[model samples]
Target chain A: MSLVDLSKQVALGIDIGGTNTKFGLVNHRGEILVKGSIPTDEFETPEEFIDALYEKIQPMADEYCEGKEFEGIGVGAPNANYYRGTIEQAPNLPWKGVINFADLMTEKFGKPCKMTNDANAAALGEMMYGAARGMKDFIMITLGTGVGSGIIAGGHLIYGHDGFAGELGHTIVKPGGRKHWSTGSEGSLEAYASATGISITAKKMRAEFPESVLNQYPEEEIDSKTVFECAKQGDPTAIEVFRYTGQKLGEALANFVMFSSPEAILLFGGVIKAGDFILKPAKLHMERNLLPIFRNKVKLVFSELDEADAAILGASALVWEK
Target chain B: MSLVDLSKQVALGIDIGGTNTKFGLVNHRGEILVKGSIPTDEFETPEEFIDALYEKIQPMADEYCEGKEFEGIGVGAPNANYYRGTIEQAPNLPWKGVINFADLMTEKFGKPCKMTNDANAAALGEMMYGAARGMKDFIMITLGTGVGSGIIAGGHLIYGHDGFAGELGHTIVKPGGRKHWSTGSEGSLEAYASATGISITAKKMRAEFPESVLNQYPEEEIDSKTVFECAKQGDPTAIEVFRYTGQKLGEALANFVMFSSPEAILLFGGVIKAGDFILKPAKLHMERNLLPIFRNKVKLVFSELDEADAAILGASALVWEK
Candidate 1:
């Protein structure tokens, strides 16, 4: 009954982003043995990207997995479909139409491959090795370039009818307010609560309050980081920006809580680094808006997964599902 | 091979409302063989209510299930908890605090019993016998005294952590717009789209436009039905009320669809009787608010279940689950 011997299985994890594609070999304990990345825009077609990926990954796979058999491959990408194993019309990606990423990866690596959107992979990562361990129902909200959500109900990720459920970022928080990036919908959660949204909020606040310290920074330099820097220096306008972002996020989180009623909502990625500035207002507003039944029952916490290794671990976790 | 001989099994369905409590003996096919109701306010205590319910239901159970063994009992009440078999601080119920209703009913009838909130029961009923049959992911919205919702994801009703999931009615549709009845939240979906809310909208429109035909009806007489009549007669203000209500509902529904990505959203209860007056505007607004991927994928339709029998059948579906 030696459990140590059984824990030797490993998987290859791939995270395909707009600018770069990161790939790594991950063990059962969520530890990455080796990882590397390539410029995604360097390739014109999905086939070309796959060829470059194979050329780069095969050497790492051979070196890292010399004594162990690679169990499978798991991929996290933009607009990925878990059920169909395809990436369809992803706005950020160069490829058009549907790309059968899993089939191509499986054919190249000679192992089963599973794929899902990045946020969902983060959700799985949290469940497997981070904040959501041993929890059945929770939502993971990633506030990076855009706001993305992965909803887990009854301990299962909800892929819905077309493998595209958990699109909470697109849900409207303020109707007819701010226009969204891709959807063009007014006042979506992404329009106000994302990293880009935070920067936009900072820009708006700078214009509104001419006397504020944020006015010193050029429009291009006034990003989420600059807002944080200004807030640390006790700038009123910069502080208000985080508060506004947090309130919008908190209200949307309340709506999401009412929808699925998850036990906890784990906040992930860049903006969460704002810490109490964002979290305090977000938690306050979420609690304030909740119905009596739901109030005080849900936990709003930052994701515990390591920022650098989370994607690979998350993608590798998908192999365990298989 | 003679399945007809074994098809005589029946279950008791109970729907506990603020004013009245309805009970029925139902078969697997969702047929109510015998049904009756009692004034819920007649009993000051839950024990008294249970006694009266037993008295009325036992006779029906014995008569209808003469040769066939009575299977179980299912109760649908406001603020019911499926996991705990209790009702906690229900606003409309006479009994306050927590009541182990399912255990009480099971103890009283000497049969297995199951209970859930009315909306969740309605969702189960729809999956088993109504518009949601053969569909794994869909939402059921009941627009009666208040707006309530039942969310089905991956073929199971989402009970969340506290057995109080799918409270879509309470989700904010118009921030800081209209105040809700119970929760007192401003601009919740229930505040603008429920039967009560629709009437309130009509009253507000009448006040805004003094020359409108809706001003002819006494304020007290302006119910959903009266609003419908007024709109049919080409009352611009009345028509505007339905349009406003539908827009709010459709926007909220679009948010819900994005969250869960359901195959359809089934509208149930009284307000939906307005038909195209509400449906057309709702459909338009929902499509308008939806993200590009979700725009045409979701179907918005009225529940096909018979209005009178739906509650009982929905309650009975809980037993089938047990």
Candidate 2:
């Protein structure tokens, strides 16, 4: 007990998203040996969630069984916290309040489990594998529903006094604005920045231009992707919407640059699918809004992570890191 | 030499402001035995800066001088970096790029020296002695000509890879709305949120309210204090300006909250003198911009610190911490 030996075992990474819950067995090198996903809505209770997850891993565990060489389990969820080992009222998930998620995982499998928010986990995934490789000080912002943030400083995630550090989405781009759900502002960055948020803004623009090429699509079915496609097809309204979205994202990023002063900020998530539309305006606005010293020095780039595997990788990373 | 056990000695804290250079000799509790200030502009060279400083500190040192007990010096200036031990490109101080300020201090007095930007040092000071005492995670924002920020997470200053982690003032609040000399657009929150920035905004409002009480003051001398005074006298224009500044500040703070998720964000410096005029608006906006769960949870308050001795207390803490 005095001098406890360290383990050289690997870990399991789990990424829980809205549509899917993916699982992966990963090594320290960020390699994914086995990976799979289960429809998230299939499981209701916490026990059921773990039981179903265990069922998926059972076959692979039997095939690659090597005693209990696995060290622990790492999970990345929409609203995960390492310190609390729980998910606190994730907007999408049915779970509410503090859930001893690690304890729940441990109760079922008898293994240590660690977890952090998806954004934070994504940051760790990037650090271990994707774009953030070799970076000791960088930040990851998921441009999805809202601008999710994960901070890395001195080669470690900055989980503050509370487990809920690194919530970049809520930062305001336009004060006293209308409304947006994500990033905590009604008319804040999320209102016009995130995909769902941007789509609504685009919907309004589409309303203004009912005769534009964008009018060809049903408003009810029209989402951000349709807007991006229209922009790619040289539709002026869609392009303007992207430009506005990029500008909002860029403005919000400017504030992040000031707070964390990171070397670079990585981007991920679905809405970034608009890629050029998303990045170009963001870059332009970011450059325009940056301090003289910080201008052109900070890098804002998209994340090249595998969307499906990222969560599992991020979740699995939880075990090894803790 | 085997252990090289560093002596647990006291340090000298020096805070050089625009008007004066305050000095303190003390231990780590942020306490001070003897402290005072000397005019800084009176000196010309680095030699003079050191000479004037030592002259003020020598007597105090003699009183508590244990010969080998005094370890080194820690300084906080408008622009400083502990890593490089220099003051690079300071506007307030005539010093240019990379002045080995610590070396100059050590050369003059045979002791080690450390330095950091004033805001960064203030953050350390707050952690060491001020209201954020003993807190492992917190952010200190100094509201002056431009807002300044210093971040501490997990009991350490978040010095990024480039030693420039905290830069709250430059965080982007406005996307592409305005032009500013300080932070430009790179999302400079100071562009629309800082006291000076707010005043500029208020002055612009004069065109609409030609007969408003604010029009009495010349545009150049107008400031947050005057606006606050007007608000107190029931001037709607001043009230609107305060609300506007607070909203901008709150919006910026919401983004910062996500980044660090500190227990509380401690506000200090000049603009805060307007008190609730700023705090009320900021708090409202912060809550609106904050994650619903984090809403009504984060504490936004003023720094309960001594203006005269804070710099000295913080500077001295630099040495005491080591």
Candidate 3:
């Protein structure tokens, strides 16, 4: 591959997901070019995941930015912590010990690097590009398999004292209630609000609506999409499941809005694709639960970033900082 | 007072509260020198409130530091916002419009000035001279009539986009529970956890156990103190109230820990005066509900700052920035 023209001012954005690893070139403005993704194969350990991803990405970097300018690398990954720059015991990737993933990138690419959780990076992405553009303060939530979120206050991602500052998912929405079984993390809206959460709610609704279309779906295969498709088809049980998810989500967000008083909450992830069935209830419930001061004040909007490019753009934006 | 040392760089701390307005002089280290307070007379308007406070405070400043060397002034008020240097409609105070309270002091005192909310000032006080000394990040919750709180991240007060961050008291634990009525703000922890919150719980428990000694006290007069006294006397109702308050407090804080992941949450206010009755249960409930990653990690500690001195010193310290 031709060496990309040297600018020494751009950055590499890397997003590591449960299923795929995405890469892109991003600037400080949150702009990206030449984004691509490769599968994240099941690795027995962290070593294999790192080696496989680096092998796939190194050539792409050489081709895209050959003799081109690049400053640093930024990564967004599950369980990635800004403080530690590692994915610590993340369930999806099958990594246990602290992985110095950023260091590995730096060693291979010889660039300054940074990393944060995918949700947090998405938040940064929105701040720099998508829905929350020009916004200094906002909360970004990725409601996928589980409810995950990030907080930006005063134009910076709030890492709190520890790097784990934006765990809006685990903020208890329902006490003593069945929530996402997040490795023993209890009372999270994630269990009831995410795709996994909707599945759980759908599973419970089986007893409530035994003859519904949901009865046809096997227990192991009941993802949010299946339920959403059923809801789209006017399946009562599926519709009810989405409503229940919104209720829990709205209630949880109302609680979160108090602490951060964000200008808006940018919603991303696969589950939100259900659109108003999920959002209408979530918005109504959120507004219902909010204080008069915050009523109709906090904007809850959907993410505009292409699902695939979000990771790389988010991670790259970190190192692409102006 | 003869011309007080003209060369001394002393900072004036002005803490404006509903009941009274306190002003004190201090060095960089936050040691109180000319400490005093004047009654904050009831006012129908914000101008009147300021006029009344300035009427008394101006003379005192004239008398004490007329010819002495003085630096800047710092003001802490309920609705005060540090970014805009104004106090908006504070819940406790009868003020409505934007009042340049900081400018009022600086113009009168002939010095530079700083201002922030009471909770934020209290947080700063902890950072400077209290239990949070040397701590870069922490949350300060004052369990008074309302559960007011302050957040400091990376050693800076986290005033959100519009300087309206850190409303910890209002984070809802129960969707529509006890605190719903009293504040009329909808499901606030402050309704159930503050001193007045304890009173609310106690009053409800009082009806359940009217035969108890609480019957001797007027229902309206049964405040947090009465409840604490009852707890000291081994009253089951009062004890249960404290336990419940602790549980509620813990749950809310557990949510906060998820977002902030702070080193600790410093408990303050007269409500926390019950000590272990409140702290122990709060700790237990927080631990029980916390995410696994934060199981025994985040510490819950007490504020050692003298309540009066803390706010006063906090206002003073505002001008005495780090």
* Candidate 1: CAPRI quality band: medium
Interface RMSDs of the predictions, in order, are 0.7, 2.1, 1.6
List, residue by residue over A1-322, the lDDT tens digit for candidate 3: 8664434446888888787777877665666756667676577666676677667767777776665677788888888889877788887775677888777767766777899998888888888778998887889999887777878877888887768888888878888777456556566777678777788788888768889898897888788888888999999888988888888888888877777778999999998988988888999988887766577888889998988788777787687444
Best by TM-score: 1
Off by over 4 Å in 2: A1-8, A62-68, A181-184, A207-212, B1-8, B55-59, B176-188, B191-241, B320-322
Q: Could you tell me the lDDT of residue B71 within candidate 3? A: 77
Model 1, A205: alpha-carbon shift in Å? 1.2
C-alpha DockQ for predicted model 2: 0.67
Q: RMSD, each candidate, Å?
A: 2.3, 3.5, 4.1
For candidate 3, report its TM-score: 0.91
**Model 2 alpha-carbon miss at residue A192, Å:** 2.5
Instruction: Show model 3 residue runs off by greater than 4 Å.
Output: A1-8, A29-31, A36-39, A42-52, A216-221, B1-8, B42-69, B210-221
Can you write out model 3's per-residue Cα lDDT over B1-322, one digit (the tens) per residue? 6665534667788888887888888776667877877666477765566576667666666677665657778888887888788888776665667887777666655678888888888888888888888887788898998888888877778887667788888778887676455446666788889877788788888888877777679877788888889889988888888999999999888988888788989988898889999999999999888778778988788888887688888887787566
Q: What is the TM-score of chain B in candidate 2?
A: 0.91
How many pairs collide in each candidate, listed in order?
0, 31, 20
Q: What are the Cα lDDT values of the candidates?
A: 0.89, 0.78, 0.80
Number of the candidate with higher lDDT, 1 or 3 = 1
